[model samples]
Target: MTEKIAVLGAGSWGSILANLLDENGNDVRLWSNSEAQAAELNDHHTNQHYVPDFHYSESLTAYTDLAAALDGVAAVLFVVPTKAIRSVAQQVAAVLQQTHQKPIIIHASKGLELETHKRLSQVLAEEIPADLRQAIVVLSGPSHAEEVAKRDITLITAASEDTKAATFVQQLFMNDYFRIYTNNDVIGVELGAALKNIIALGAGALHGLGYGDDAKAALMTRGLAEISRLGVALGAQPLTFIGLSGVGDLIVTATSVHSRNWRAGNELGSGQDLKTVIETMGMVIEGIPSTKAAYELAQQQSIEMPITEAIYDVLYNNADIKQVIPQLMRREGKPELQ
Candidate 1:
């Protein structure tokens, strides 16, 4: 059976997933808020703003009309930034009200919104109509959209309270180059995806400060501990943090050059100001705000997250990044895994 999928947000991640769906024999309609971007994809079969070298699939259609994209769609795939989830979900809900059937939503955004401090899935659940929340699923992993679009081997996970929804999404995206796994721990999956970027920024900062393998290893370990503490505080299963969504994502984001957060940290460590670095990258760097949010979350939950706090101070308070190194080392520490 051919499924009709509406992919919202015409960014690299959205385009890659839309291509994956097209390869899986689904009818994909890609919707971009920017009409110009939609037209470019519709006419040129390329998202030149993100991935230009790859060819777009003929089975995919691009549209600026939200209603047209949602019409008769079996599933909705959201690939926008975490900040845009609420407004987009509200639009989707309004459109679905005029439609005959509600589509199952599968999204791949990472990062919690700063204002409400809500996770993407939580925002969707709060904003989308009650009936649609049950069918929501989140897909996340160490996937760099550019690599995935190039047919690189990328493994990801689909998580939802509804196992059926997870399985359906897994089947929708699995391909020769893209592998999908199903899990029911939405909390763990989303947190793991969002929190790693913050830690990656810390890792990059350490690297920029001329730290070696020993320091990097310590930061990664402590970063994972901070991630686990926040996850535990937020009702995530303990073991999930050790799995793909947690350790897997942390390793990739903290180490990969493709990570925007890592790159930002590298620039910061190399002594570039935040404003200058952001202007140079010219793309969304998700780690900066996420670091602040995670720091707030730790404080609220009474969870001890030293790495997140340290990064938050360095990022916001203009705390000396180089000075924080010895400060962390001097802290009276207890057992490794307390």
Candidate 2:
């Protein structure tokens, strides 16, 4: 049976997923908060601003009305930036309360909430009525929006405490080109997804600062160790760190040109100021915010996350990026894995 799926946020990821759902023979309603963007998508079947060369599925419809897009949907896939999750969830809760509809909640954007340091799903649970949705699923992995838009072989994980909800999401998104895996480790999945962005930022900074592959290898290895440490402290299974949501995600985000976090860090390493980089990129770099949140979390939990702290200093404190390289190298010698 085909389900009516509401895709909130008309960014590259959201648009591509909506098109994929249409391809999978589902009724997809693509919602954009911007009226102008919604009009362009509906009239032109394109979201050229975010994905300039990709074509959207004509069968998929676009809407500016949140309630209307979700009118009869079975699930919602949120692709907005991390900062926007709370506001959007509140709106969804209001709409659902008004319409008395309960849809499976799924989020694709990554990054923990600032100050609160809550995951996207956690934020949703706090804002949305508990009876609105039995469980919230998180979709995350190494897949890039550009490649996924082209139907490249991409794999992502759907995670929730409810295995049934995760499996349902896997079934909803899986196709010939896109594979989905269901995991009950929501903590591991979301933490891996959010934390890798910080590592990716460091990787890009290293690249921009003229470091070679050897440096990147060391950075990723150590980055994963710290990620695993923090994650395990927060109740994530250590083995999950070696899986798609962990190692797989770190490799792709740290290496891919399509990653906004990598690109932003590249600019920072190239000597651009944070304000200028943000203005120039014209998109949300999840890593920057994630770095801050991770840094705060590490301090509160007393977890050692050196890479995250270095990146946070660079982004928030105007610390010299080039100088931090030797500083890291000069740190007292320690075992490879702690």
Candidate 3:
């Protein structure tokens, strides 16, 4: 069956996924905020600004109007940044209300709402009424937009409390190059996906500081501990931390050059100011805002996340990266499992 799907946000990840759906024989409507981006995708079958030198499927269409893009779609994927999730979800709710269409709501975005400290799924649920959506799903794992654009083999998890919903998403996205796994641990999957970006920033900073593989290995190991601690405290399954969305994502994001958070952290450790790095990159470094949210959440939960605190200080407090590294190293040693 050829399902009509609405993929919101024409960023690199969103555009790639939209193209993948088209390849999988679906009617894909990719929505972008900019008229030029929409025209580029529709006319040239390319999104050169985000994913350069790549031609998208000709059957995949682009739209600037949210209502028209979503008209009669069976599923809607939210791929916008965490900061924009609420506003976009609100608009989606209004459109669905008018059309009386209840579609499956799936989000591939990671990171919590900075203001409310709520997960993206929670924000979507609050903004998009249950009556207007069949179910909420989260798609996350070690996949990167650049690699997926190359048709590299990628595996990701689709999580939802509803088994049927999760399986439906699995079937929707699974293909020869892209494989999907279904998980019922929505909390763990979302937290694991969001928190890994913070640790990836730290890994990049280590690399920029001339630290070798040993330092990065230590950072990733201890970083997973911090992630598991906070995630478990926030009602996630302990075993999920060891799954694809957990350790798998941490390993890939922290070690890969394709990660924006890692690249941003490298610049920070190389002595560039945050403002300069952000402006030069011209992409959202999710770890910056995610670090703040995680730091606050750790304090509220009384969970000791030293790595997150260190990164948070560097990003938000103008703390020197060199000084922060020594401070982290000098902290009182404890049992490794604690």
Cα-based TM-score, every candidate = 0.97, 0.98, 0.99
* lDDT per residue (tens digit) for residues 2-75 in model 2: 78999998999989998998899899999998989888887888888899967787788999889899897899
Q: How many clashing pairs per prediction, in order?
A: 0, 0, 0
- The lDDT values for all models are 0.86, 0.90, 0.94
Among these predicted structures, which one has the highest TM-score? Answer: 3
lDDT of 3 by residue, 264-338 (tens): 988887888999999998778889899999999999999999999999988889888999888999999889878
Return the lDDT, model 3, position 96. 99
Cα misplacement distance, residue 194 of candidate 3 (Å): 0.7
| Model 3 TM-score relative to the real fold | 0.99
Better of 1 and 3 by TM-score: 3
- Residue pairs clashing, model 2: none
By TM-score rank, best first, the candidates go 3, 2, 1
Off by over 4 Å in 2: none
Model 1 Cα lDDT, one tens digit per residue, 101-147: 66788889989899777889888877777664448899998788888
